[model samples]
Target: MLGGIIEFLLLKQSLPIGLSLLISATVVSLIAVLIHRLFIAKTKNATELSLIIMTIGISITIRGIVGILVDKNAHPVKPFLSFSSVSLFNLVFSSQYVIVIFSTLVLAFLLYFYLKKTLSGKIMQAVSMNSLAARLFGIDVGLVQMSSFAISGFIGALAGAVIAPISFVQYDMGIMFGLKGFAACVVGGFGNNNGALIGGLIIGVAESLSAGYISSSYKDLIAFLIMILVLFVKPSGLFASKDVERI
Candidate 1:
């Protein structure tokens, strides 16, 4: 929500879309780091549930603040390219959709390379797997945690910026995307990037099909329903690996 609004404001100022997205992503990344450092990291004896609640509180606070400051109105974002739509194989797609798909693939590959080939990324994996053990090995767990927050924020802001052109920018727009993302994660299985990517694809296709065949009003519902069904049949997700270390 905030990211989309920031990008919208930057575009309003006649900034190049690339520059606006970069600025928005950087600002949000900084904000996420501050959130972890000031609130999350400062918490004592925090359980998963407590952290989840605190994050939810923080999200609500940010949403309310943005609504108050930016007004509760939807703003249109222009497509990044000149063309509005494109046709391929007799099918039509929004140009922005192609951009979104290409961007997602490129980012995923970069993230995969970072996590698999970089020492810092290995340290992050170690920290996530066993923070206490990583600390014993002299790794800075806190720094890794902060870095994770920054990466998440940066990716989220970029997603919001790109998606705004298709979904419209509004204070409350993140909620649905957030929910759907969580559903995708559930469907994909936690801790598996490949699973996540496949899960997101599944959810996206399901929503599109539902909107076309059933009703647009129930498209979001279809994603969650698939998630629930996946949980029932395969709680670990469709592509979940039995070996935790490999994931």
Candidate 2:
């Protein structure tokens, strides 16, 4: 919803495609939770997996219905930005992809700082890591859990909006990417936003490189392989620490 509007705004302003997508993605992602938390509150689902399943199911169902109703062969909207590249050091990447990278980085740092510095952030980290102790401290566990899901959902939707243009976002579009990203969240360490960010980036770059140098069909598989390897080696995820503060 927000992505669509931002795309329209970019078209109106004549902003570059890459810049428009990046800006819109961040803005809309920041707002996507208005709906994500709405659903979570109405339904009583807990845990990231449950929220993920719920959101994924909704995305697929809506898209599937649209695909059937709209006629799947309809032409997609064209990119509002250019694919031309400019030098940014030594590596050459899509101007759009570069924006994605930078946007992710900014979001990651903001989240990390929020978690490490603010009172609410500490409450969330403590609650997520140890609900019993958090409750013992008189924190509302349900509220904290909702906040966590809300943040995750907002990020997911933001990813959906940003990546939608890079690929044609049909009704069924969110599944593969969402699955890969969720795997990334797990491999990076659940409850750790920094982990999710790094995991997503690693997955994204690996995916891009694999598709560029290897096979496009194998791009998505890399996330699963990474997840399996990480599970076997670390079990708790690459960034998980003893500081999870389990109750």
Report the number of the highest-lDDT candidate. 1
135: Cα error in model 1, Å: 1.3
lDDT of 1 by residue, 1-247 (tens): 7778999999999999999999999999999999999999999999999999999999999999999998999999999999999999999999999999998999888888888899998898888777899999999899999999999999999999999999999999999989888888888887677788889999999899999999999898998899899878788788875432322
Off by over 4 Å in 1: 242-247
Residue pairs of candidate 1 with colliding backbone atoms: none
lDDT tens per residue, model 2, 1-247: 3354445456457777667666766665444445455676677647878877887776666567656754454234454346645566787866656666676788788888889999999998788667899999999877776666556655655555555556755555656776787778767887677787778778878888998999999988888888888777776777875433233
Q: What TM-score would every model get versus the actual structure?
A: 0.95, 0.71
Model 1, residue 220: C-alpha shift (Å): 1.1
Model 2's lDDT to the true fold? Answer: 0.67
Tell me the spans in candidate 2 whose CA falls farther than 4 Å from its real position. Answer: 1-59, 65-83, 212-214, 242-247
For candidate 2, give the lDDT of residue 70: 49
As a whole number from 0 to 100, the lDDT of residue 187 in candidate 1 is 88
